[model samples]
Target: MSHSYHVYILASKRNGTLYIGVTNNLAARIFAHRNLRGSAFTKKYRVTRLVHIEPFNDVRDAIAREKALKKWNRG
Candidate 1:
């Protein structure tokens, strides 16, 4: 069976501190973030809400999208 890749954005609250990342398992990844185990930035900022998510059939596409989103100015 094939796996799914996801590009997701986590936030402390609406329009609050944001964390963007990619994961193969959305639920598990979000769970980790909620438990303060996802990443140092997310944990420190308390970015626990799964505000946005995008699925991709190719991991490369997910990664590229992730990079693009990360480069975007939060303005």
Candidate 2:
């Protein structure tokens, strides 16, 4: 199966630490963060709950969306 790219945000909790990332496999990526894998930032901040996600057919669009979310004020 072909996988689409996704821009996603993970939070430690509601209104807590936020992390923005782009991934081709959303489930596996989230799982890794949750399990405290190789992600230093996410693991250090304990940001594991999936809060937001935007799917993109193109890698450029996914990266752009991730960048946009990174600039958003945490709410």
Off by over 4 Å in 2: 1-3
- List model 2 lDDT by residue over 1-75, tens digit each: 464998888889988888889998998999899999839999999999998888888999998878877787755
In order of appearance, the predictions have TM-scores of: 0.91, 0.89
Reference-based lDDT, each prediction: 0.92, 0.86
Candidate 1 clash pair list:
none
User: Residue 62: error of model 1 in Å?
Assistant: 0.1
The alpha-carbon deviation from the true structure for residue 25 of candidate 1, after best TM-score superposition, in angstroms, is 1.0
As for candidate 2, its clashing pairs are none
By summed lDDT, the worst window of 10 consecutive residues in model 2 runs over: 66-75
* Residue 52 displacement (Å), model 2: 0.9
Look at candidate 1 and tell me the lDDT of residue 65: 98
